[model samples]
Target chain A: MAASRERIREVVDRYVGLVASGTAAEIVDLYAEGATVEDPVGSDVLKTRESITAFYSALEGLEQRTRLLAVRIAGGEAAFHFEVQTVADGVTYTLAPFDVMTFDDDGRITSMRAYWGDDDMTIG
Target chain B: MAASRERIREVVDRYVGLVASGTAAEIVDLYAEGATVEDPVGSDVLKTRESITAFYSALEGLEQRTRLLAVRIAGGEAAFHFEVQTVADGVTYTLAPFDVMTFDDDGRITSMRAYWGDDDMTIG
Candidate 1:
């Protein structure tokens, strides 16, 4: 059976929460083994589980919070607008990216492409 | 030269405004000659200008309004969350779709895929 809309919404919520507080390993677990991640869209895609883990690992120890501003799911895929605020060395950086993801039947993410750029980030 | 971030944002704003009040021909002028549109994502793509124009023509005489809730542009591409409210026969239908679009250096849209399912729509 195809992934249900409820299931997809649950996963999107979980993903945002994990990005805020869970370990990188925990976030990586949400994806299928061969999932691909292309955060910031124009960047190189991270294809292997190891690389994907590394990508999220960068935030493992950061002081950050995330909010899912909005999400639209259709045909086993979701496009979400989310905000990530990170504080380091007494400065806060905020970026809201629009991410598109496709999921497998089990609701595991198959691919993710995030749309944001340097110009979108604001520092305070 | 690549499309600038400001240009992309301007285009996004114009596109939303056009959806709300412009004619099908006016909206089609925002695309390149060979642009493609796949509204609601899993549907058949409209590749030619004629087909794309036909798709938007459905809204020509409708009592409708649109709002751009959010948009993120990166790498000459944009993903936007927008709301469309239509009233017909004394009933109002509202649907918000997350649309992803790629543009050329001239800021003309090259392709678009909208993400929204029947479950996301509401009637009042």
Candidate 2:
């Protein structure tokens, strides 16, 4: 198995599209109905499509900026490390550690796990 | 495939042993020879057993503290997201984002990619 930057780009593109265009559905499209999202410590595990949608709906005005730090693929799997920045509730939350992403054959992100500090740490 | 904390604990245990015991070889035992580790953004790709060992060797006296945030195993793979703290040259670095780890059937980490800020963001 091998991973191509182009493939990863497509995923990133979709995410960017979600932010630049401010389309909530775009984020929904990238995930399966049963997709899961977790904070840096995996404390807040959100499951199902509805919660996922609600999750994005609440972030209506907080734009997201993603930096493609690195992408690599092998053995039929790939991982993307990135930095995410956004403003929520007048607070800038910059989780700039890394998030490991894995996708299925269809290029849909099966899991999005962030690596950063606990809830006490916040940055712009 | 499913993941259990007990299983994940073993891996973390080995890593912790490497740190608490200060035995370089213990760390080596946790990774495959060809294993690759990237900084939070996937930069600084280090491959091979020797380099991995050398990588840790350089941090001889530095101490590392790991907090087990969350872990899930569905399929044959698992992801554990947690925070890492260490001090270097009187500076404390706390990469509290996360790293996604995949393991082989033998339980050795196949890949470890950290998620945190780029080199510019350093915290204790």
Candidate 3:
């Protein structure tokens, strides 16, 4: 169990690094084949790997970076708080998001739910 | 700074304990006199201790319990994921909420924002 917890933590750290480096293709590889993502809690779940890959591809063009503020892992799941900085239309924006993710026995993310709303974004 | 992080972590633990014990009044006391809360990200902010107290009072009649899933603290802020179990009208409901909170220098919670939606609830 302890080893599994450590692996989940490593996966989370790798996620941050990959996002900061703009390696979108590599990011998708960290998830299991049928992983689902529901960003912003109330939104529709994105289930297809193709759609998930495309969702990450959108990040490739943006000058974006992520800084992890906090992380918690337990019961084969992890939750983290992070701040994302991005530039769009020459304006810098900061977004704070809290994400809860569950992993399978193989340490691949099976499901991810991000919690954030427009109110959590700030223009810099 | 480290001491402040420890204090914040302690406060978060206290919050979980108080909620589990059904001590709603004392839970509100963990906040500063004028702390603000937005339990659901898109909801209107609740300001003033009286209003906050009343909001918590609503918890008193429910058979509720909280189990901490994860906690992270940094930069005078903390975010945690937890499961809330409550019985209403003889039905058991489970809620999963991710909360981000900022604390004042005095170790009191200055602001709390909970991220959850209707989709996050499960009835048993």
> Pick by lDDT: which candidate is best?
1
The candidate with the higher lDDT, 2 or 3, is 3
DockQ ranking from best candidate downward:
1, 2, 3
DockQ of each candidate relative to the true complex? 0.79, 0.07, 0.05
Residue B98's lDDT in candidate 1? 92
Give lDDT tens digits, candidate 3, residues A57-118. Answer: 88888888889876656556777778889988989899867777888888898998776656
Give the lowest summed-lDDT range of ten residues in model 1 chain A: A69-78
Write the residue-wise lDDT of candidate 2 on B10-120 in tens digits.
886566446544666667777766788765443668887887788777656777766665543433344445555686687777654445666666677777765544432
TM-score of chain B of 1: 0.97
Better of 1 and 3 by TM-score: 1
Model 3 Cα displacement at B66 (Å)? Answer: 14
Error of 2 at A82 (Å): 16
* DockQ, 0 to 1 scale, candidate 2: 0.07
By TM-score, rank the candidates, best first: 1, 3, 2
For model 2, how does the per-residue alpha-carbon lDDT over A1-124 read when each residue is reduced to its tens digit? 3335457558866664464346567787887557787754346778888877787776567666756555434332344445567766777676544445666666777777655444324575
**Candidates' chain B TM-scores in the order shown:** 0.97, 0.72, 0.92
Clashing pairs in 1: none
Q: Tens-digit lDDT track for model 1 on B46-123?
A: 998999999999989998899998888877899998999999999999999999999999999999999998878999
- TM-score of candidate 1 on Cα atoms, chains taken together: 0.93
Where does model 2 sit among the CAPRI classes? incorrect
